[model samples]
Target: MSSDKPQNASESELPQAVPVRRRRWAPSLVWLIPVVAAVIGGWLAVHAVLSRGPTITISFQNAEGIEAGKTRIKYKDVEIGEVTSVKLSPNRQSILATAQLSKEAADYLAEDSRFWVVRPRISGGGVTGIGTMLSGAYIGMDVGKSAARKSEFTGLETPPIINADLPGHTFFLRADNLGSLNTGSPVYFRRVPVGQVVGYELDAKGGFVRVSVFISAPYDRFVTSNSRFWHASGVDVSLSADGLNVSTQSLAAIALGGIAFETPLADNAGIPLSDRNFILHDAREKALQNPDREMQPFRLRFHQSLRGLSVGAPVDFRGITIGEVTAIGVEYMPERKDFDMTVDIRTYPSRLDTLSRGSRISGKLSPQQLIGNGMRAQLRSGNLLTGQLYVALDFFRDAPPAKLIVRKGMPELPTIPGDLEELQRVLQRIVKKLDAIPFDNIGQQANDSLKSLQQTLDSVKALSDGLNKETVPQASKTLEQLQQTLEATRQTMKADSPLQQDVRSAAQEVKETARSFRALADYLDRHPEALVRGKEAQP
Candidate 1:
């Protein structure tokens, strides 16, 4: 009983001693974790919102030169934006490239801004953008000048040949054919490059091809209203009377072709205008030959064969080109009752101008007036080797009287005889002279002379035979007889003959008599006058 009481009292005393300081409800450290997390998350959200940039969607025919994460958009070769994603549009006909542009570049996006894939290209001008090969292709952007901003853009299929700010003038050139000239073909002035062909399009009327070209400053001032443009493609080899003429620009033009222009020496005095239309000629000669003038139509009747002549054959005046043949047709004239050729020719009055050129010709200088002044047309040989013919006009002061007639509103000019007709007339005269020759009588006389010559030859042959046979033998016998007579005479004169001995004795006697006569003369000389009796007495 004492132990139980002590245990109970001990329990009560211990519990009372703690005084049980009432446990107050307080917050735990676990609640602080959520609050700290909220503060950090709020700061991160604000930072992300502040750093975000404008998003732009670019449409392209195909997704080329673009990477979702790695591809960068460059302006002036500086990175200003990055491609974020590439997706197809709702129509699925094109690729939509969404890009994130830097805040500064956002203002640069405009309607006029151009974006194109920069790739390696080989053009008439030569290889360009070749760096794209090693670095891989990339998108090139040309910043627009417009103040208006736009986030979306459509990409270009090809890079522009001329930059809008290239500091030059853009002009149009119309041609019937594109030739070998392509974009980037050089535009040359006197073979020095000054510009390039940018682009081309077909006319809506299908009449011609229109090409766009750019001419840089300083050189642009050289192009005038009368400046002529022509295709300068490859080496122009012309075999002419002057000799073989070989002309070439750069080696690039030899392969890819090019365009060249020059202000004609005749038309260089005109003022130049900006952005004008110029005709594209097929060749340099064609461009040089072209005259800016009003064309007057005329007709010529050719009685001779129209060989070595074409529609575009030149019409010349004193070796100077004045027009060209436009058409050639053969029609029978019921009155003439023969096939007559109707040749249509267009004459340019500008060719006659020494200074200013006028289009409209007055009635005072009409075709009828010119024909009345002895102006005649004739065909002449242009090239001897080629046998090419061209129409020639000159004042034929000796030409017979003729008149100009109008038919179908076109002036019909009188044509004098061409060289071929003159040649034919000469041949006809020769034939007539040949016909007048007495060929049959000459043949008969020639036969008679041949017969007489044969008879004379036969007589000579008989004489030769008589000389060789009978005459030769008789002459030989006579010569032998004469030899015999000489031998007889020689024998008579021999040393052993009596006749020779008698002649020797007579010669000795004469010699002795001469000795005696000489001795007598010597004695007479000594005795003074021995011729008297004195010489005998002395003897």
Candidate 2:
């Protein structure tokens, strides 16, 4: 029994057919971490496969500031993709760059998509992409409207001015020449900058430069069909009757050329619209001096030289400007056998009326009628200091009769001698009158009169000398005898002697006649017409 117990203990402790606890074939909690991790990895792999995006290739002339890993593609200033690779094209003429775009941006890639490198640039409008300097260069993209999907694009050399997101309208400007103007030039509204020039191309057939310009929303409405555009780049200086006019848009505009526009008066101007073409003038005067009515060309032939008269000289009607001299020519007149000056003038007939529009009544009075009514043209002085001459039209009731001559499809205006010529004619008449005076005959008559007067004076002096020498004693005796005779005559006249009475009566009659003559003289002085008709009796 002892031995059996020992063996049983040994067997129980060691080798007894011990029932093996059926090992619950369960995985450890630590092992479960790997399975869950593997399942998540598989799911992420499947999601990544489903979310892969399209790869697009872009061709560029030069890969100036592009790097594959560092450069990013942007749209509306937001990152949308990354550049994967940049390689030289097989032809070596261009560079082919590959970009990987996010799935969200895949739909935006279309046939018309445009891409350009964003870098710091100074354009006529102003400095652009300055912020890109610090951030390094990147690819700028503009989404296209085309519905067709595409994965290849031709890159642009410069940034685009027209885009869907941009809030502006593009218009065309036609200029004879682009002076100091370039792409990105500023467009001004009354000297205030409001737009920019995007591009320009020469029209070979039309012989004009067509510039594309963009104006923002509110300013765009100011562009009308009657709007005038002019170059506002440099300082405009003009010397006129008013004063010196010096004008400029801004300091920046002097360095970079600019365009300016102004609409006509509200009463006469038309409405504004987008995409309308406008003519760009070279100067402000040309733009502002828009004539409201049509002009007619006329010819004037003058006998005097056109030395001071030049193109742009004013044609005045009674001191009011009505036209301008456009051309001056010389011609030899066969009839007159002299060289005549032919002047071509452009006149706005509408200027004759207060309103620019002419009426039928005024239009009926032809230019021929005006010429018949003594309307004539003459040269006048405009500026005495500058010696500039202008044309003057006036009426001279006594002007020589003349007729109109049509030459080269133009009517010739009758011209008369200017005021300077009239003065010369009057001077010549004065000289002729002076020459007709009898100066030699008058001198001979004056000499004879002086000789006769001198002879009479000599005789009177001799008689005075004879009286002083010999007649002194005789004169004393004569005076004594006269005094005695006067005393006797006085006594005889006072008394009633017959001879004295007769003399006294004669003196009284003489006194009476003198009084009558004095009265008549006074009456005649008071009323000289009394000689023609006797004076009326007072009532």
Candidate 3:
């Protein structure tokens, strides 16, 4: 093979022949740039597709504290999304936030989910959100998944109003002041927290205020009766020399603008309780329900001089509060100068008896029965140290107190007799009778009579008592001596021997004579017509 191949030319002969035309990059290098660009573009596209998520638009009245891209969406306090874009709404009215929600939280975006902004509340009642004093502000939302619901959300002007879903139609309550009541302040029934404050508003009417409450399911049924939406602020009252004062017993319920109701239990009624969620969420659609007829506004009048007493004071009957004082006003007609308080009371008549659930007059109980076995109206001291008075209902009969009534210049409600008042009246009557007496004459006569009577009685008692102790001993000794003298006289008469012998001789003579008389008496006894009797025995 080596012999067959011809020897190559000198070293430079082969390749130095052609300085292979080199390709240029400024032009062809631009093609390489295209390849690099393709790789970068492909990377960006993959990232964009994989990180894709849903866009949720939330509109707010103001975006004072919320930041676009910084705002987060949450469900049950868990962060599920972040805002991506911020812009005014199409109407140029609201701060529209375009947020990207994590897929994990999307399922919770329910049709009934709610969104609101938390802020400080300033009112005459009191201030709320001490947190806002430091934490600035944030958005609170209840998430739900409902494609049917509007994808857009409008943040509430007021904070979220937490309330218990009640039975029947939801009530509309408006107040001028909601106090420091929070979104989740517990609503109570006689001090028992049964519901909570859910949200509030500056009423669409721009007047008064709107409060949203969440009544629990069973408690919602209690709302079968209309409830009073009042302030649950401070319990206030004043006590003075004129009379007892009281406030905020049952009316304490209104202090916080909470929900309270009386539900009548039944054996055959349909499910009267409503679900426990905001009706505005979805239950609003089913708000066409009729309320129970038996649930009526409890009525009571505080016919008294309510000096310093407020309208929202509690009205209790026998310690069990049945209502509250809604309006404290006065009527100037008929010379009956009185401050009459119109009360909004609530009473579940069917609940009067623990055993009876149905409404029937047959089960009507007497006031006394209520006091001992069923019910009692206790006039409670709203503030014992304050001497504020209120009414409470319960069963306590160990004490049968006296009734109450008006006296002096003090204006009083026609209250059921309390133990205290009855005692007062009796004392007053006795004092009046004593006042009617001529004290000077009676006192002198009584003094003289008491002195003479005491002396005479003392003398009689002393005479009888001393006779038994002092005179009886001497009388007993004299009687014993007289008995001994009689015995001695009888023994002396029998000691004479002549007297004994003569007595024997006479006895022998009398015996012969007695024999003859006996024979004669026998003959007379045979003669039935003969009389043989002493003068006294003849008849």
TM-score of each prediction: 0.64, 0.56, 0.36
lDDT (CA) per prediction: 0.84, 0.85, 0.56
Model 2, 353-417: lDDT tens per residue?
64445454347677889899999999988887887899998988899998877888899989998
The predicted structure with the larger lDDT, 1 or 3, is 1
lDDT (Cα, tens digit) per residue for candidate 3, span 1-539: 77545454344356666467887756566589889999999999998777666667888887876777666665545667777888888888888877887666655556667776656787433566567557555566765435665567777776544421223233445555656555655565555667666667885778766666666556555454233333443454555797776545244344443343333333333334343222221011112223323432333344433444455555554443335555544444356654445333444443333223555642475333443453444344466466565555555545455333233432232334444445667999999998998999988999999999999999999998999998999999999999999987777568465677788899999999999999878867777555645323345
- For model 1, what is the alpha-carbon lDDT of residue 226? 79
Winning candidate number (TM-score) = 1
Tens-place lDDT per residue, model 1, 189-266, is 998999999888999998999988899987887888878899998888988799999998888788877899987665
Off by over 4 Å in 1: 1-67, 83-100, 146-154, 221-228, 236-245, 263-275, 281-294, 303-307, 328-340, 355-364, 397-401, 421-539
Winner of 2 and 3 under TM-score: 2
- Which number leads on lDDT? 2
Q: What's the best-to-worst order under TM-score?
A: 1, 2, 3
Off by over 4 Å in 2: 1-59, 85-96, 110-113, 123-126, 144-154, 161-163, 240-242, 267-275, 282-291, 298-346, 354-362, 371-403, 407-539
